[model samples]
Target: MSVQTEINLSQVVVRQSQKWQQLALGLLCMASISSPQYVWTLLTKPLLARLDVHLPVLQVTFSLLIIFQTFLSPLQGKLIDRFGAQRFIGIGTLLTGASWIGAAYSQSIWSLYLLYGVVGGLGTGIVYIGVVGQVMRWFPQQRGFAAGMVAAGYGMGAIITTLPIANSLASHGLTQTLVEFGVGFALVGWFASRGLRPAPNTDPIPSATLTTGRHYTPSKMLKHPLFWLLFFMMACMSTSGLMVTSQLAGFASEVGVSQVVIWGMAALPLAMSLDRLTNGLTRPLFGWVSDRIGRENTMFVAFALEAAAMTLWLTFRHDPLLFIVLSGVVFLGWGEIFSLFPATLTDTFGSQHATSNYGWLYMSQGVGSILGGPLAALLYQTSHGWVPVFSVAIGLDILTALLAVVILKPWRKRFLQH
Candidate 1:
């Protein structure tokens, strides 16, 4: 072989290695963002006990976190588009770490709000857009799977951190635990962010897909009816999942289950772990399924399954076995929403601007998060029961299913055909 051809092959090998590195980085970025969920239980308990706050009041922290994610995502999306992922990841990771450290020293809810809710949430949002955008760029053909893997890391990170955080809280106080997590996450995330790099000009496949006639800017996308329908569907789906996750233990107790059963239900994290795993697996599976069966069909199946899961939960509240089964079903179906939406959006608007579009799509999740906590709290307070909360969730899922069937059908046909 000619020396020039050998050199070209060597360069190709290097580029392939770099892409794999980027994928690993994307996974780490997700893990860092997700690690906080495990810490949620720990923080709430200690803050309420030590600071003498009530659960309802302390729960506002979650709302603040969601609100930060909603507002910060668009800004992070724009930054990633202009400056690329590396700088955003670096600075964002640093801020994430600093926020943890600050949280450790927090003596009041306001201090925790400024640290955990604002700074940490913003940091996660920044890294989130960068990692997701980088992964999508790396795997244009396998966007769903790639997005799934990245998102799954976030879920899995919670599983990985839960035991450690739980153990740490038992041995060390909250302050010390926060310090450790803050420093560790920052260091790990900073190194991981270093792996992100802009796609080379030669990486032209995704760009070509964009040029093939369907492209919509953010404003243009908003003008389309399909976008709002999907947006509301996403928001509703997320609200259901978040409500269940945040209130699982409380609901279990309210149903007259023993304290032992309540603690056993901590196994809900294990369920959530499974949910994340299935989420990663399903994205590629569902995305591929959408390619064949159609995106609308795939979403129809997902939402229908979700509605059934919620209904089952309401019906079987007293049955542990059935509740577990329904919980798994709900999480699996919920996972599909995260996995499929990006692929659907990319198909509609084109992958060239997918990160920004999906970033906005993710804000719907933030909106759900903001609403889920207070809504569930209010429902539980007024009804003095869990049944009403689950009932409302079922209605939302059914509405989402209807919208998917009617509105999303035509949108998918128009956008995904080419």
Candidate 2:
């Protein structure tokens, strides 16, 4: 064999190794950012107590955390596309960890809002979009599964921390818990992010790839009807998940199970841990299914499953055992948006401007937060029951599931054919 042949083989092996290494690093970075959003419900009661703020006002801080994390994603996506993933992820992680530590020392409501709401939102948004986008670009051949694994980091990462956070808050107080976890998140995120790298995209894709064999810039992608279909579909489904996630503790308490022990564990914390695991698992599971059966097909199954879960949850919600079990199913059905939609977007639009294009798609999450968080909360208040809130979410899930086949499948085919 020629010496040059050996050199080429070595280079290929090294690049493959680095690609997987980068994936692992991205996963850890996402995990570090998970607590701010996923664990917010745990902090609300304490935050309200220390500040003596009303529920409606305290909920704003939570809403803004999601809003900033999502609404700002399009801009952050473009920035990641231009500036690269590692830098933004590193900086976002620092701010996210610091936001917690800062919130631990808040002297007033507004100060807490600024630290946990504004800073937390911006920081998580940057890292969330950056890591997922980077993964999609890196593993175009396995876009769905790759995006799922990274997203799973965000969803599942909290599982390891939920019980710990609850225990910490119970024993050490909220302030110490925040300070200690914040320091840990900061260090882990910083170290992991140092390994981040965007996969090279120099090779031309084949004409028969899942994409349209044409690329669209973020601006051009907006003009296509297919993008809007995806945007609305995502908004509808996102609303269902976010409503449940944001209000779990409240609803669990109303059902008289938040503090009830199930095998020596508080129902709410145990539920949170279960939900996180299912949420994390669903992303990759459905993403892998999408890679084989197609994105829209998997969406139909997952969305319909969530719709069924919501209805059952509402029916048996008064029963603590059913509530805990059904909540995990709901998450398993819902969390794949982080996987499916981005993969679909790249498949439909091409990956050249995937980060930027997906940014716009991600903004639907912000929209969902508004509808899911405050509006759903208001409906529960006015009706003085959870029926109305769950009813609305169930409707959205069903509609989105039907549209996945009835609308998205046909429209996408036409879009690609043309």
Candidate 3:
């Protein structure tokens, strides 16, 4: 072989290795930050016991966490875009860890609200949007699959910690567990953040796979009706998913299945662990499917699946074994929005200013958190059952599914035409 050809092959190998390294680091950073949200349901009983609060009032903490995480993402995204990923992500992870450590010492619910809700939200928000937006820029050719992998880390990261945290809550108590794990997460995430670098400059792949070839800034994108439609659809999807996420443990106990043993393990933790697996799996699964079938088509299928799974879940909720299994199914149908929406957004709006644009869209999840976390709890308090809450979620899922196909696809096509 010629020396020139060998040099070219060597460069290709180096590039491939670098890409995978960045991907792995991004995944680690995502997983490191996931626990505050994903494991929150597990924390509720202990928090309620410690704080002596009403259910809806306690839920406000969760709403605050998500509200801050998502609401501030635009500003966070802009900063990451300007000052670079490593500095912001490092600071974000430290804040996230500090939130947990502070929560460990917090005696009052209000203090917990400030520490776990506001601080944790800001920290995780910076890491979450920063990492996902970075992934969007890095893998322009494979945004769906790449975003899915990192989002999967965030979705499924809790699986490893759920059992440990549950066991710790049983033995060591919440305070010790929070401090120990918080420190570990902070260190690991900060170290991983150092490894992240901006995407390298490359010539645009001519008329790349599905992108509109027209870049839209956050300001320009905000004016379009289609953006609002997509926002509404995402908010619906987020509401369904976050409702289950934040309310799972509460609803299980309410239904008298929380303590029931399924396969020698308590049903709630088993369901939560399984839900994480399915949640993580679905991001990539649906993302890959969307790459082939188109985003709206994939949305219709996944959203309909969630609606159907929710119906079965609500129907057979009293059966502990079925409850555990269907919770996974419910998430399987729901979690892909994390992957699909960002990919679709970058595809439509263009990757220039992708992070900032997604930050604005990410705020929709904050809306879902409010509706799903506090309002849903209040609905339960008033209605005296889980049926009403689940029914509303199911309706949103079906409506969003229909909108994806009937409205979004054609509207996007027309918008792109001009």
Candidate 4:
């Protein structure tokens, strides 16, 4: 009954509540990421077949999805800053569920474009920013790993859904399968979005007081040369990865691989899942390394590995084992960028508005996604193979590496001061 004892009990209760909130947020993160992948299997083929559309035109729907996400993510971030997470995620989830169901009944390509491309993409954009921003807020001390875990869910969700959706499409027909996906997404997203609430009375923690003394405002961070360099680095990195992801099945077919084998290999979702899982685990480690060794140093290693992996693919395209190994490496390196970039943003820009700032940084991924497939397709058409295409990708990796070293120099002193 003592006043001191009451204070201690209140503190314990607060800590416990925060822990449960974090747990719920993490689960929400996983569900938010996974929901989109339900449609990946039907991205081109099933829809194209059912709707009787040309491949190129059908692919435009995919591009529209990326375009929507690209243009809307920053806006969503601003909304998150204004309204907080719970409301944004809840409304977004509702829209996303409706879009998916509408997509299932599309009688024309334009309808698909409207439903999946515009509505679904916009819905995802809102939820994506909400979940990721909330994670960063909840785990300011572990932003890199926290952000990576949420982002990784996006990749891993695709992996988890690929086989099941593919199987469903094969057996149940596209419309039914999508209908089921819509229902599932609606139910899960509703519960998950409702679970997302910000930690009470939390303020942005400055890195200076912590082990890493780096922070910047979005406007100020934009002034730094290194921010643009890192931004472009991520853009190109995304271009390379998405090119491969979107074209994996086609690539297998072009190389004279069997349909059964191609379908089996299409399970790059396994590789994708591993890539994301590794990213979640390694992000904090790399952040620690960046804190210790330096961000540029960590980036140098990532770009080098990425370039090397791409080279392996070019050299041994015929060997399935080598292809898978190289693909895995490529995905792993891609995950590193996702893991490191947000932390780098936090380091360069102040955490006062880190969520919004990083959201703009993430828009680079949408740009890359928009360009990646089309670029690869165009290059493949012109070159008659992936050889030329991958060569260009390698060049991009090299360019990113050089830029990272040059642009990050000014921050080197600041980083070392820590």
Candidate that would win on lDDT: 3
Residues 1-418 of candidate 4 have per-residue lDDT tens digits of 9999999999968866775576466555455545453345345677767889655566667667767766677778877878887787777777777877898899998898899889887877777777767776666666666666666665555555556776787899878877787777767767777766665445545454233344465677678666676678789877776776666656755764324333355434444444445544454456556555566777788787778887987687676555656667776665667667776676556555666777788788887877666667777877888888788778888877776677564554464364
Instruction: Tell me which residue pairs clash in candidate 1.
Output: none
Task: List pairs with backbone clashes in candidate 4.
Answer: 215-349, 215-350, 216-349, 216-350
Tens digit per residue, CA lDDT, model 3, 1-418? 9999999999878867877788899889888889999999888889989998888888998999999999999999888888888899889999999999999999999999999999999999999899888888777777888888899989998898999999999999999999998998899889999999888755346442456467888999999888889999999999988888988988999889999999999999999999999999999899988877888999999999999999999999999999999999999999999999999998888887888999999999999999999899888889999999999999999999999999999887776666
Per-model C-alpha lDDT, please?
0.73, 0.89, 0.90, 0.67
Cα error, residue 217 of model 1, in Å, equals: 2.8
The alpha-carbon root-mean-square deviation between model 2 and the true structure, to one decimal in Å, is 1.5
Error of 2 at 367 (Å): 0.5
lDDT of 2 by residue, 1-418 (tens): 8999999999879877887887899899999999988998999889989999877778788888888988888889999999998899899999999999999999798998899999999998888889988888778688889999999999999998999999999999999999999999999998999989878864435543377457789889899888999999999988888889889999999988888888788889988999999999999999999988888889999999999998998889878788889999999999999999999998889888888888899899988888888787778888999988998899999999999999998888787777
Choose 3 or 4, whichever is better by lDDT: 3
Residue pairs clashing in model 2 are: none
List runs of model 1 lying over 4 Å from the truth: 1-15, 202-213, 256-285, 415-418
Backbone clashes, each candidate = 0, 0, 0, 4
- Span of 10 residues, lowest total lDDT, candidate 1: 202-211
